[model samples]
Structures are given as C-alpha cells and as structure tokens.
Target: MRRNQRQAALVCVTNQYSCERLILAGKNLALSEGLELKVLCVQPPEYASGSYLAEIEYLFAVSRRAGAEMIVYYRDDPVRAAVTFIHANRIAHIVLGGVPDPAGSAF
Candidate 1:
C-alpha cells in the first residue's frame, strides 16, 4: 500500500460459504466508501477436500468483480495468518467470523 492510498479492509472468513457472505458485505462497504476489500480465508490442515482452492478461486472472482484484492490462506494458525495479512496489507479494519466453542457430539 502506498502512503497516499486508502487502506483496505481485511476480512477473515471461516469457510467457503462464509467467504461469499463476507465478500458481499465487504463489497457493499467498499461501494459506500472509498476503500477496497482484502478477503482472507484460513483453514486447518491447509487443505481439506480441495475446498481451499475452490474458495480462493471464488474469492478471486468476487474481488475481480468488486475491484478489490483477495488474500486467502489455508494454514494451521488462522488467526496469526490473518494478523500477518493485515500487517502486510496495511488493512484499516478487520472483519472476522465467529469462533465456535470446542465441544463433542452427543452419543
């Protein structure tokens, strides 16, 4: 990011579906304001069912349509990766999904 440029929003979407939702919201925000969106996705094990790649492609499409940049990462430490992205991109704000509590299924 340049010094005279406006900061972009860093969105941490948990899954492919959530990424779509976040992209929509981010686009709306960007449209209302003079800012861009930086969509970021983080997943455990980095790859699962090839969904990560699909999500990245989806994000890219959304970003291209919205005139924004997409940054997706599949890693073990999602939060850390997101933080790194935020710092690297000089993101102004962070939009994140809720984290579910750790629990087991009933017998």
Candidate 2:
C-alpha cells in the first residue's frame, strides 16, 4: 500500500462458497474508489490437519483473479484476526460475507 492510495479489505474467514461474492464486491468497490483491495482468510484450528487445503487453494485462485491480494492466516480466531488486520492495514472499507445462523452447524 502506498501513501497516496486508499485500501479496502475483504474478510473471508470460512471455507464456504459464499466468499466469491465478497471478493467480487471488494474488487468492484476498490476499483470504483481507487483503493487497493486486500483479502484475508483465517483457517480455524479444526481444519489445521489439512482437511480443507484444497478449498483454501481454490480461494487463493479466486481472489487472485478478482485482483485482490489474498492472505491466509492459520490457527486463529477469524473475527479477531480480521479486525487486527484491518487496523494494521489502515483500511478505509471492508467487505464481508453473510454469517450463517449461530444455532446451525456452520460457522
């Protein structure tokens, strides 16, 4: 990130298909506002055994195509990490996906 450019971020903390829309939206917003797009994905501890490695790779590819610089953080709380990253990057805006119901099995 340069001093003259603004930055927007997309937080995709889960291994779900819905992140595509976030990436797309972030890309569009960044382009429209002349901001750099940054993407973050945090892998939870349960998936540290490489169960979802392939899906992570797919996400990396998708984010790259969307012109976002993607970063994958391992073994951390997704929400907290997202906030930390956003603050560190001095991001002006953030794009995120819809959260599933807390009572349901997903996260």
> Which candidate number has the best TM-score?
2
Q: What's the TM-score of each model vs. the native?
A: 0.70, 0.77
TM-score of 2: 0.77
Q: Give the Cα error of residue 22 in candidate 2, in Å.
A: 1.1
Q: Candidate 2 residues 56-77, lDDT tens each?
A: 7787888889887898877567
* Model 1 RMSD in angstroms: 5.6
RMSD of each: 5.6, 4.5
Clashing pairs in 1: none
lDDT of each: 0.69, 0.76
lDDT of 1 by residue, 5-75 (tens): 67787666665655676777777776676677777767777475574676567777876786777655667
